[model samples]
Target: MEGILIFAPFFLIPYIMAHIFNRVNYSNRWMTYIFSGIVNLAYSVLFDFISSYLKEDKSQPVCHFPLFLFPIFFSPFLILLQFMFNKAIIKSVKYKRNDSQNEQ
Candidate 1:
């Protein structure tokens, strides 16, 4: 339960962003990938900054470049998930349209 709470944002944020993109009808593959990467990078930096600030070690550097790289390294996988999510949303919308059409 506690662990899920910690990790939930990592998954949820991308999914929510994908949904918003879909809602706005922005389906460009490269754009989606780049946007998700930037969002994840910002999130990683902010989280690290807060955690480090709360720690007692004022001597340690707050910005860890390697930690920032994780988002870039895993962006392909994240983009793949976003693609799938977008496809699923599209399919659902199509299904609803078809249902309404058949009723009419």
Candidate 2:
């Protein structure tokens, strides 16, 4: 769908933000996932507004901010991403633990 175009840039923005802003000590995965989603939603809206101007739409709507609601529309994918991030972190921690144990 053409609507998918507006969300293209957002797919990665939130995931990257989740990593960069991720708190290693925090046990609340939900908080991290939701916070990152919110941040990316804001970024996606801004990107949509800015990109809409770049688009050659002669009949462009006055407000393209709604285009950035992809996260809301694709919440299942967001949850999947959260699962992946958590799994990866768990794997990394386990790997580190194994390595330390081996070193001793």
Candidate 3:
């Protein structure tokens, strides 16, 4: 669990942000979700690479999975996060547009 802690913020923060945007009925929520996933993937890849390079001369391992394998583990949850956020955004937008149309 401690090991997970290091990567937790990278995933958790974006997940939380996506929920916040969904609540606010932000336009382009799908785009935001996609962008966040891309950013998270990039962050995981970059961090693994850098940490692997640093570990070469040390006795510590930054991750249990191989360098390329880290993204595989990170991807599913990130994609799920995107899907949920995108759904919320779609519903919120639809609701707001309907509300406005009714008002008019």
Most TM-score-accurate candidate = 1
Residue-by-residue lDDT tens digits, candidate 3, 22-65:
65545656566566666666666676767677565667545546
* Alpha-carbon lDDT of model 3: 0.61
lDDT per residue as tens, model 1, 1-104? 53463345557766776677665644353465567778788877776666667889888666667657767777777777777766665333333245766777
Cα lDDT tens digits, model 2, 25-76, are 4465557577767766776776676676778875956676466556677767
Q: Candidate 2: list runs displaced more than 4 Å.
A: 1-18, 21-23, 56-66, 90-104
Q: Considering lDDT, where higher is better, how would the candidates rank from best to worst?
A: 1, 2, 3
TM-score of each: 0.64, 0.57, 0.52
lDDT (Cα) of model 1: 0.65
**Model 1 spans with C-alpha error above 4 angstroms:** 1-7, 26-30, 59-63, 91-104
Candidate 2 or 3, higher TM-score? Answer: 2
Q: Give the range of the ten consecutive residues with the poorest summed lDDT in model 3.
A: 88-97
Clashes per candidate, residues 3 or more apart or on different chains: 0, 0, 0
- Local distance difference test, each candidate: 0.65, 0.62, 0.61
